[model samples]
Target: MTLSISARFAFETDQPTDVLLQFEAAAIPEQRIGKANTSLTQAEHCARVPAEDDIGERIWLRSQGRFDVEYSAEVTIERLLPDLGTLEALSPHEMPGEAVKYMLDSRYCPADSFQSFVEGEFGGTLGGARVDAIRQWIADHFDYAPGSSHVNTTARDSFIERRGICRDFAHVLVTLARASTIPARYVACYAPRVEPQDFHAVAEVFLADPTVEGGGAWHIVDATGMADPAFTAKIGVGRDAADVSFLTSFGPSNFLFSEVRVEKL
Candidate 1:
């Protein structure tokens, strides 16, 4: 499948400020990029650096006065994912150094806090089955209320409130998966059919790599069921949304407006 994505946002500044931008579709083996371009206005200084896992790049800039950003790209996805039920789990000792950290606690996920809940709620299921169960549980119980959560919302908060946006759903999925001894990370991406049309977030878990010997693989899951892994184009991966937010400013700034469009081509 192919997708065309465009992300544009405006920011007003009283003075000069530093900003980090990360809203481009990643160029990985599974996704091919074409006709990609990005433009920044009023940037006194600008540079690009690699994002987490080298999946994408982040744009660092010094913006003065009013600024605007526009990014557009065409991406084709060629990926195949295994059935979660058929994939077996691997021991912690068998996990790679990179995967191990995802299983640990983070600011938003706080996987350790959910360990007891996981044991009680999903004791019978293991490996990918457990992951699927967690995803289904979230889908069945939570409400997709847009304004129900705020910036400081955590997985526990969402679990209790039983509602949140895409990022909140992703956070809860990551927390529950990690609590179940699965290494799960957060993902920022663009997908064709997300309602209200905005940047999307999902969870990616590390499981057995049936393709390689004694190796592990990462699979993407969307507890919100808003974005399908087969059609989603990732921006990057992080411990939580804090790490892969599309834009982060170091100083105070006024938010203007944002426009995001993703469509099948």
Candidate 2:
């Protein structure tokens, strides 16, 4: 499959400011089965084109001064790839304790409160009656509110605060899954149900049971439960929100605003 995408950004500055725009533009590199190939494309300070291997893409901008800016990104991910069986074999009764430890201690996400919450709440397997329980637990705990907190907000804080965007919800889920000893990752993309023309966040769980289908493959889950299979476009994945933030800056940012528009053309 092939797709095309474009985004527009508008920034109003109180004063002239230096800007460095960085967006997603890399092709999905071919990878071995049972492993996810999610990485960011290095984009210059302007428009970008899809790479030869890209099935999905993203666009972003970074400015280097204090000013008001509005930016929009357009992304198209096509060539819907089928999931090949990659799940590993494991006992169904086991919890994801090991996975969680790695994630909290890992450099990807270092929030201490987040680590503790996962260890406390993530205490079961995904099979049998626990699957629904896991889903319900996530859904009941968080509310969807974009821009409620800065990116640095910890999962524990977001949970306590009880309000955040999809990224925060996804982060909590990813952390919980990992803490439970299950392999989980962060997914960045747009969910049509929430709003087709905007970006959102989702979590993916990687099952370790070989007997199950797609053992090591990623399974998309939305804590917000706000997606339609029809309009959701996945961009990339990583340990947490920090990994797949469509727009990342090297220095600092202030009074930032973002918009996204995705439509079939």
Candidate 3:
């Protein structure tokens, strides 16, 4: 399936600010890019860098005065979602070195802190079923309130509050999976049919053992229940949202407005 994405960002600055942007689709094995373009106004000293794990590209720029930026892209993504019952979680020793980091605690996803609860709830559950249960548990308990969470909100806080946005949902799920000894990571993506039309957050679990009909793969899940795996376009992957923010400014800058749009083609 092909997806078209467009985003606009405006910032009002008193002096000058340096910004790091990660709005482009990831160059992963499952995604093929057709075309992409970006434009910046009142910006200079621009450069590009690849994100960790090759998940996406980041652009760095210096903006002065009233700054405006726009990005557009068209990409084709191939998603293979296997039956939940047909996959098995891999043991820590069996997981690859790269996957090991995801199983550990991060800034937003403090898996170690939730060890007791996760073990009590999902220790006996196996494979993708465990992940599905976690997702459902979050959806049933948490309220999807927009301003309920901030950048400093951690999984523990969200679990206690029972409310947050997509990133908070992803953080809690990621923490629960890691606490259950499953390798999971946070994903930033362009989600089709998302209410309010903004960048979306999702989670991916690495399944190491598979049934005859199901292969070992990274299965995507949206705890917010706002995205379909087949239609979502991945932008970046990280231990948590801290590593995949769409825009990070070094200097002080006030946000004027932002808009995002995604459509299936």
For all candidates in order, the CA lDDT equals: 0.92, 0.51, 0.86
Model 3: runs farther than 4 Å from truth? Answer: 209-216
RMSD of each: 0.9, 7.6, 1.9
What would the per-residue lDDT of candidate 3 be over residues 218-250, giving only the tens digit for each residue? 789889999989899999988999999988888
Query: Over the stretch 109-193, how does candidate 2's per-residue lDDT look in tens digits?
Result: 4444454654466444343223234556878866677679886786666767978777777777666655554556677765545
Q: What is the lDDT of residue 150 in candidate 2?
A: 83
- State the lDDT at 62 in candidate 1: 92
Q: Residue 158 deviation, candidate 3, in Å?
A: 0.5
TM-scores vs. true structure, each candidate:
0.98, 0.61, 0.94
Candidate ranking under TM-score, highest first, comes to 1, 3, 2
Better of 1 and 3 by TM-score: 1
* Index of the highest-TM-score prediction: 1
lDDT score for residue 48 of model 1: 95
**Candidate 3, overall lDDT?**
0.86
Ranking by lDDT: 1, 3, 2
TM-score, cand. 3 = 0.94
Clashes (backbone N, CA, C under 3 Å), per candidate, total 0, 30, 0
Per-residue lDDT over 151-205 for candidate 1, one digit per residue giving the tens place of the 0 to 100 score: 8999999999999999999999999999999999999999988999999999999
Question: In model 1, what are the clashing residue pairs, if there are any?
Answer: none
C-alpha lDDT of candidate 2 relative to the true structure? 0.51
